[model samples]
Target: MTMRAALCIWILAAVICVGRGHAIVKHQAEQDTVVDSRANTASLVNAANKEFVFRLYRKLAAHADSQGKNIFYSPFSVSTALAALSVGARGETHQQLFSGLGYNNTLLTQENVNQAFQMLLDRANETTRGFINSGTAVFVDNKFKPQPEFLETLRQSYLADGFNVDFTKTTDSENTINEYVKEKTNGKIDKLVSNLDPSTVMYLISYIYFKGQWASPFDPVLTKEDMFNVDENTKIPVQMMNMEEELHSYYDQGINTTVLQLPFNNSYSMLLLLPDDMAVLENDISRGHVTKWLKWMRPRRYDVYVPKFSIKTSYSLNDVLTGMGMTDMFGDRADLSGIAEGQKLAVSEVVHQATLDVDEAGATAAAATGVGIMLMSYRHIPVLKFNRPFMVIITERNTENILFMGKILNPKME
Candidate 1:
């Protein structure tokens, strides 16, 4: 690889190796704060800006699906990275966001970004600690925070890498942030933060954009009782979306692995590829043959039978990430000196939680629970179908940040 490319790879490797030790934000425990008002107010209205973010979500979803992992993805961090960029983020921001996630490298300013990192230091650390205690099986996991010194490294790297430097606007941090979320999720995600307390040290914002249709929409009326193979002795009431059709890349590989794809109304859709006999599907997923299979397939309709499911997954990402290569930033060797002079600073952690309710109303019926409830006219129905082994991608109209991508081999078991 060329020097620049090599440098990029090294930066990413360092992040992967060091990311696990960071912490989670602490304010999330404030339940009485009220979700409706905080997430649905007028102080933050950046509609056109939000649409732009959605484009990124779309791109990310497509790329993840292409990579072959049964993806249960999120681009919230990516969106935050972009937001940081909008306000002139530097190297640390890029490292924390890109390196931490295994996405392509991005460059930004060092001093400015480090300052921002310093601003969020305490909360970031807490987030990491939470992950260490919670774990990934919970579904929603927090992304780690970078140490201040690490943020400096990120800034220096970006400058060294020839990244375009742009001035940031902090005039209305809240408005800009919400606007970005709106655009990223096509307005599906709005008011990620409400009533930003200037005194509040750490503020986290995510944009979840999804647009997928069922391989076959369930007849709202014909929904009947069926045995959902959740496990050997577990079967429950499920609205089965049924359709018999031929698919482009259907796989029935050995080891009881089965893969299938269901296209959404747009370029995206839901994918459900399952392992026939594996006790746990994640093992099959971690082995890594998904990207190759997805890339070499065609897009065709198939007859599918899927059950409607509502899943809530919350996780603290410390261990899984530590296991994934981000080790340095966690312990002693961590270089977070930049956050505070002579002060021992390390990224505490990240905690991410997501709840998905898929039904005949549409693929991303999530909007009903969010901003869409108010803007009744702009609401798009959600379509939920779980039939063959398939993949699901929620991408924005432009940009590389994919909102969410993952395969539901068997929603029954998860």
Candidate 2:
């Protein structure tokens, strides 16, 4: 699948349909000496970033789960994995891989996009108080020697953790992949790759981990078992935490959904999205509606009730990715020659594993995400009860870069 795959998956969310092959171009850096400070460049980069995150979520949310199952992953994580590979991608291999990851070669340069993510990561990791981390790595078969330029780009741009191993030694190699995932995600995701195909040339992955403290702590003493309406037919008990004080929030009258922003000490926030209808996940959420909803939000205080929940999800993104126009890199026509001297390279598997934990204090998450690669929002506080299926997002306040997202279809499913 190439840019035209964008045509096949266009309806996953209408946001990305505009990215046609010839019509769209890679991102172009503004002709400024300090590109980061250029307002126009920053705005375009932010829009592209948000569009990419929303695009990935719309695609995954549509196909990654079965009926009644909750799902979550870092779009950034998946994109990061693909971005690392893009460093070594060439010819159609580079186009398909980068395009699938939402890079329009005509509109933005990889360097421009990479710099945007780098800035976002730096902003997220600026202080160690509230943690958000994204890193890349390559598990190469010892037989292959990666191009120095490819390795250098990964190191400089993505802060990669590169490794070499004998793919023929399945036991040791598998352990190595899992161990790296385990260590990077602070142990939240221990095993991402189970087995490496003997013919597998290299396995690339990215990991993201986040843990944030609520600006205003929810009192555990207020926690009580309550019913969360999964739907009209199913109501399950959940440990509900309450914050009675007025809190900032946004309520979209059009969608009849309420959005609440809970801040962290480190300039990050977990945005909760609660809609009256539980079946919204099955329906395509309008992209522009969310942008408007976020813009409309103003600080208004109100009481809030949220459940204490924990859940984990894992996926093989091959089909989902191909469905979204990323077909070439996984197949023979792939030209990942930029990675090595002469041996042809193609991705064998893309795996993602994610987990989320939320309580009165805050939210913590870890995972190995696919492009299995690696990677937010607003609110108001009018008295709200998240007594049904809702959504949660962790993001940086400045760039609004999403670190993680989850759809709690059934709070008790975990």
Candidate 3:
């Protein structure tokens, strides 16, 4: 049996800031000087983001709802949205956001984080090796006015655009926000907002759309139907894409996992990990393990089989973020004074949606986060068949930033 395969994923997150008030500023500098001064900051931010990625992933995996199910998300997208929100955060709210994002332990200050995000946003949106479109937008209620410093900060540091909407007209407001996200994600995310809160003074959204062709495209003719073991007793048919080539691979004896590195035409690559015991791998996996795996990988020729599959996941991250020490942002005690001076503002909702599709041509992904905020791989040669559950991590080669990460328990389950 043969199956058609195409890799395309979408992620969206939205944050709803509820309050009433108004505030406005502007500055510009020589582009050359700005870039030179922030040259080292991007890597620092990227490191912090990576640490948060695994921590968040472990949290997601531990959720009861995620048991025996496929997981997919864009950590970079979520971080970007929260980082943008942090601009308007004050006191404990800011500290919670900082610590929750794993930036507190680092040497980075808030300004450093902003500069790094600015650099990353610029690089991601550039028409370079692959198609990566990342952007942020704030939808403000016409009746509400944010602080001048807040808006200016978002615009300068996060590359965010501002729009005015009448929140009283919920449907219209939702459509406006959704349409912008849909267009940015190439229609990969069409319905990003629904049932807008009338009290909401602002809505912040962050989205990332990525489409990349594989460096070594798989021949469609070589794809054949095969069986995937979902568990001990369950098996499902899948379109297993096959290829035999010299590829970077590693076998970690400590955790009994096989790692494979699949490059994209751009400066990105997918790392796949198939483990003998998923529990052991999950418990032991960390940044150190990933660094070691990359360092230990060697080029080798092997027969590889990857299931062509697509999966979509939606998460309500309020509980997860709260569990991760981001409690103040969602409660009555929340202090977002920097956003608006006279009004009490708190985050009412956070939603994240992501989708992934993998095929012979390559992989394409889109993610959106709304505050209503919300917030790989591989292959084998040596008869490395992904016949069972495995992990997928897509990372940028130069920055070492993890663009997306998840686990595939069953390709047939979207």
In terms of TM-score, the best-performing candidate is 3
TM-score of each: 0.47, 0.82, 0.86
| lDDT of prediction 1 | 0.37
How much is 157 displaced in model 3, in angstroms? 1.3
* 64-86: candidate 2 lDDT, tens digit per residue: 36446887777667666676667
Task: Give the better candidate number (1 or 3) by lDDT.
Answer: 3
Superior candidate under TM-score, 2 versus 3: 3
Ranking by lDDT: 3, 2, 1
Predicted candidate 1 versus true structure: per-residue lDDT over 185-245, tens digit per residue:
4454355434443322223332233333444454455455565554465555566755444
lDDT for residue 290 in candidate 1, whole number 0-100: 40
Clashes of 2: 34
Candidate 3 segments exceeding 4 Å error? 1-37, 126-130, 365-381
lDDT of 2 at 288: 66
lDDT of each: 0.37, 0.64, 0.76
Candidate 3, residues 1-414, lDDT tens digits: the string is: 321111111236221101011111214555876656677666777788889888899899998888888988888888988888888888989999999998853577789888787767666655243366666788888878789988888887777779999888989988898899988777877887765667677888777777766787676778999999999999999999988767899999999999999887767888999999998988888887778877778998768899988788888788888999999888777788888876777887676787777877778533221212001226542588899999998877665678788899989886
**Candidate 2 C-alpha error for residue 61, in Å:** 2.2
TM-score of 3: 0.86
